[model samples]
Target: MTTPKPRHLETPTETTERERCEQWTDQLFRTSPMVRFMAKHLSLLDCNPLSPFPSASASSSSTSCSSCSSTNPAPAPASAPGQQPKLVIAPCPPSIAGGFSPSLPNEPTSHSSILLCSNRIFSKSHLEDTLSHEMVHWFDHCRFLVDWSNLRHHACSEIRAASLSGDCGFAREFKRRNYAFKLQHQNCVKRRAVLSILANPACNGDKQKAERTVDEVFESCFGDTRPFDEVNNPRLNFKATDEAVY
Candidate 1:
């Protein structure tokens, strides 16, 4: 006979935090141009990302993809088809801000969802940043047929996410004490990608291995920004004028 592990419960404070975070996350998903754009693009794709990870497919964009432009632009996308991925609020390990999870092969009907850490997120900005970061992973999975189980593939996505999600903006990079002006953005992206990749169980907490994986795909992955036109332009501006038409 085996005893089941005790179930942990959220205290009042934790529950309040969770609810607050969940509400904000919902609002962000609704109002964030970046999130909405990616969601719309994912919906336009024909494949199911959770359906046992298919071989790499050709990327697709709709006729209205350029609608995200504000002087600059995102790829053109026209209309919608599939269901939007869900944004789930749940407890996460202290070290993790959030995670992107794809349903197992056995659950063909299920799709990938993003999990936001209620306790770890301190403000709306943090929540937006976390959500945007995870969305990049989701976008890559749907558009590129990424095998999340593969370390190199995982590292590439992480690098692309961190690089393209506005996670390494100048101020944030400066705060991290990476003062070298030369290649600061690239360095910040690589360092953050390594941290994220190391969190994966497959890396076994091996920093060196994680760094190596990130390096191998850094050039190509960092340069490949899809669903968006460029880095630092996640199209987070949710203003009505900037919003992409679905």
Candidate 2:
């Protein structure tokens, strides 16, 4: 069976949400301290909501290497490659947007990525939190820190995102419900991490691989916290630059 592709959001309401996303993404690179600090290698670009997703860079054979035969796939250099240049912000179908990686499927993503999203359901603050989560993934990819093919790598990133971002915050959770007793944040992070990891079909359709991978990396990834000690707010201050912010 052919997998259904993500539908592009185009309704009147969706258009407004898309406009808001573009503004927020631009603001993030400009003001977000954590994002700017971590994303030194990446260059922020002007994005058009109507523009198509950034095309994948083609790996053309190096004609410069006269020593190798033209037919042979040029041997990959030993050194690690550079980070994907820009983080794209695009609108995706409701099913895939908000929480999914704009990274290409089944790929660790050596090239650029899309920040596929819509602000219809989530607030501006919520959107920033989500962007920060993806940015962590971008940090890992750019630095060649992990083998993206490995399920454990993905699981570890998810764990870090949940633990680092306010995704598992007590205030966000208890906003509606008046729970008598306070709950531990770790439990929330763990549960959210599992759900995210298991969402990947590449991790084997919500079965053993995804769960086990999370379990194996849970201690290490959850324990390995950075940019924050443990669940502190990471809001950024946006400064106006030469380019006008919408």
Candidate 3:
């Protein structure tokens, strides 16, 4: 028998949340049907941290579509009718640092573009989180064009995308960030109400209810389960509000 060659092992490198998010986005398009659909209509461009990739390159320029290049020509159009949408992925220009902005009407030529920015300025999770957010924007824009109201529905869509992107952990992080913002705003009553609802055993699916209930009871009895005094102190015009308010 011929000797089998040993498989090469790649070393793992530490990555920030933003880098992780970009990776997750790449993986998502590769696997998710809905994501793949969106990817077709919307180009996901990776922004170069080193040099500025002008919006001009994204719009006015007509480079060959990344998905249609010889090495990876677009797959046979999905069974569904209509022409398959095309997508392009490229490095983001250096000028726009924190995040990529979705195309705006003023920049009509830039429509159907998704900017992927450098991760140095944001947590790796933010890159993925923002991409998911932008994808929802694209879906809305595709269906509604320029209707401003369509963006309102994006919050829920973003949540679903982020969850499905294998970045459900971002949900918890989002809640934490929101909580901190609320605290900073001195919205204690609202914060407590929100926390109570999040702490509810029933919200996390019925299957998890039993375990969550036990955990809640244990925390109530032994842990500092009470909301922060600044947030729920009865002396400061605080009153126990309906949990549903959250």
For candidate 1, write residues 49-132 as lDDT tens digits.
212223222212112222333332232232344323244455567777788886565543226656677778888777777777
Score candidate 1 by lDDT: 0.63
Q: How does each model score on TM-score?
A: 0.72, 0.62, 0.32
Error of 1 at 224 (Å): 0.3
lDDT, model 2, position 5: 22
The lowest-lDDT stretch of 10 consecutive residues in candidate 2 is: 59-68
Model 3, 23-131: lDDT tens digits are 5554544544434433444332221111123422222111121133222222322212222122222233443322223445664433444545433324434444445
Clash number by candidate, in order: 8, 0, 15
Top lDDT: which candidate number?
A: 1
Q: Against the unseen true structure, what C-alpha lDDT does each candidate score?
A: 0.63, 0.50, 0.33
Tell me the TM-score of model 3. 0.32
Native-referenced Cα lDDT, model 2: 0.50
Residue 31 in candidate 1, Cα distance off native in Å:
2.5
Task: Rank the candidate models, highest TM-score first.
Answer: 1, 2, 3
